[model samples]
Target: MACNITKLPLFRSISSRSFASAANPKPIGGVCDYEVENSTVNGVLVTSAENNSPITRVSIVYRAGSRQESSDNQGVSHVLRLCAGLTTKSASQFMITRNIQQVGASLHCTLDRETISYTLEGTRKAVEQVLPFLSTVATEHTFRPWEVADIVGRLRLELATRPPQFRTVDLLHKAAYRTGLGNSLFIAKYNIGKIGPETLQHFVNCNLTADKATVVGLGVDHKELTYIVEKIKFPELAGQPINPSPYKGGEIRCDKGGDLAYVAIAGEGAGHNNMKEAAACAVLQKIFGTGSSVPYALDHGMLRSSIKVTDSFAISGLNANYADTGLVGAMFVAPSNVAGQITENVVDILKNGKVTDEWVSKGKNQLKAAVLLASENGKSVVRKLGQTGALTGSGISPNQYINLVESVSTQDVNNVLQKLGRNLSISSFGNLTCVPYLADLK
Candidate 1:
């Protein structure tokens, strides 16, 4: 029986409430609630959000990701990410871990195609205790050869456990952009030993510059963070700017032995600068749905429902926004024999898909809910603030962002769908005979 929650919040309660009244009601992101400040400490950019929480999150985000790496230095960024919190010039790896644990703080590193971040989360006092340590981790690192060797072994194991779908998206980027954004986040097995400490150091010296890095703090005082940031010195970005690589539509296939095939079909969509289009693409993603929200079930989205059988298959929408370009499409995983049928159906739906007012409204509401929920998490807010600063030099409130999503009409979604199909790029792995080619998609 369907529960009637007409009067409750669409997301918080199990309701079939109409979103027309709620749509564009107010700005929902709430990032603007905090007093945001931006300053340059000795050439390093610092963006802070004084959220007034006892706990604080400090992140050092740099533009030195895979996109900055060249053919010779491939996988250097991955190695650098592993080296975070390791031995620095003034501290040993053991000492670093012990100190953070003693202070009851959490420290970790995260990387994407365009950026790498090292974050520390704890009480304000604990964060203060580790600011200098984080600075060392971000800049004054001593990449010893033995430590680099150890990290390489761990990276190989990490790469091995990833599902074939993850590798497929990596290949999709390679086919879409060829290089730059095309570079894979996971290092190739052969490049493991090849990425030495010297190469990592060179990559750091050239990319981790004061100009390319941002120190972002959430739930911390702006003045205090600025004072701490002023004392740390970082190398300048001495490398020449990387040339822009446009999206070159194509396909890449790997015949890894497996019973199921993993496929991702995509084309250029919206860049980060075009947030309206990005938001529209996100609504499309939610409308298409990604697999199932419930365990042992499948979504009723167009692609999922169109499939006659699914015990052997899984498919989802793929929408990713980047600094200058984006990818919008679908991913499919199915038994080798049935993969072709599933892929064909999904592509057909995407090419000629129709978006209704109901789907658009639901998608906007869901996207708004996700943005609000992420804001409730301190770490997520920190990352959001950092990304805003890095990309747009400012932040938007959750409420404002919600309105952006709410404003996406069915027409916007249809336009984005048409754009995605205009120039398709297909990436397939595992069993090959069942996945469709770019020509087949056309």
Candidate 2:
């Protein structure tokens, strides 16, 4: 449900919905109808937040991410992201860059496992002058063979420079879901330059349509965004489907044989529909610990056993929520000699330990603070706005965000923790001599 919502207004019914909609037909003049407003303009999804800040961010978010790729079109998303701002059907790369930079507006692209965004950022007036570029870069792609070939080097550079931890997490997804959500964010080494123009076009035709797209704005008026979205007349196709990502917990190890080891162990968690459970899983991650809040100081809150290692070891709870399902557990970096001991100990605590009220309270506070901080930051706020709107169909306000954190209870936290580690998915990189296998850990 990306943006084809019709009939019902998509904006959250915050205050008196009937009164607000009737009294305030405009987007910004007095009191906000809602902190975040969600609506549909001519069958296209629009989500936005109005603020007094000078900076404005507008993104055309499409549900076509790496997960949207098919077996034949694997790694097409990676190629597609690099192809952004290239010679689109409407404008050349030089024209797009020069116009955006002339107005001090920045046009950029970002991708995650589930979505891709082409965003424009600058002052309101400046952004308005260059807003057309955003839509052009996002929706219109010429994908000339030569231009597409130029990005091959960039793709190689990205994969070659990835850190060990990143590689480990990539493998972890492969072990967890096996496909769909498990698809690698980076292109496969063998497939470089293999994803040609035809495949990229095909992938977009299937998944980058209006039914799978969301128009998101921050510090910009909703009406202004609505007008822009309506004018663009986004492309749409009916009945697009994706491979399901079901949790099939297992082990994936990358035996790189380094002195240091990177490990991520996880189990099934909540999904997008289970908001409360997702919040509870977040709390459980916090209670187990999210690393040290203080710079240079190690976290002594959760995974307390890691503290006694005497050698350097970093451990933080992992919680990820996706459209269908999620994964939750811990990820750590430690000396290869001690990786097995630390892994077993962390597993023991997550599966057998009982969380106290004090830890739960602390987790709530930390989680709330994080939410507030993200809500306030200009860059993070818009990204969150775009991501949530694109994925959930409705956006969340800062207040609603904090309230979600506050609503989780001690029982909820404990219940979520108790369900983890049932069938662990483990991914690690480094010396295999000492690091234990999933069979060994189980």
Q: What lDDT would each prediction earn against the true structure?
A: 0.75, 0.77
- Report the C-alpha lDDT of model 2 over 1-442, residue by residue, as the tens digit: 1111001011111232111122222332222224899998766679988755667778888877888777887899888888888888777778876777777778778888888888777766667667777777777777899999998888888888888878888888999988898899888989998999998888888888888888988777787678668767567665268668789988887788769999898889997778899999988888778877899876876885444677778888888888878888888899988888888887777677778788899999999887776666766776777777777888788788778989999998888777875777888887756778788764
TM-score of each: 0.87, 0.91
Worst 10-residue lDDT window for candidate 1 reads: 1-10
In the predicted model 1, the residue pairs found to clash are 27-399, 27-400, 28-398, 28-399, 28-400, 29-397, 29-398, 29-399, 30-397, 30-398
Worst 10 residues of 2 by lDDT: 1-10
How many steric clashes does model 2 contain? 0
TM-score of 2: 0.91
TM-score of 1: 0.87
Candidate 1 local lDDT, 52-141, one digit each (tens): 566677888876678888999888888888878777877777877777777787777878777778787776566666556676777786
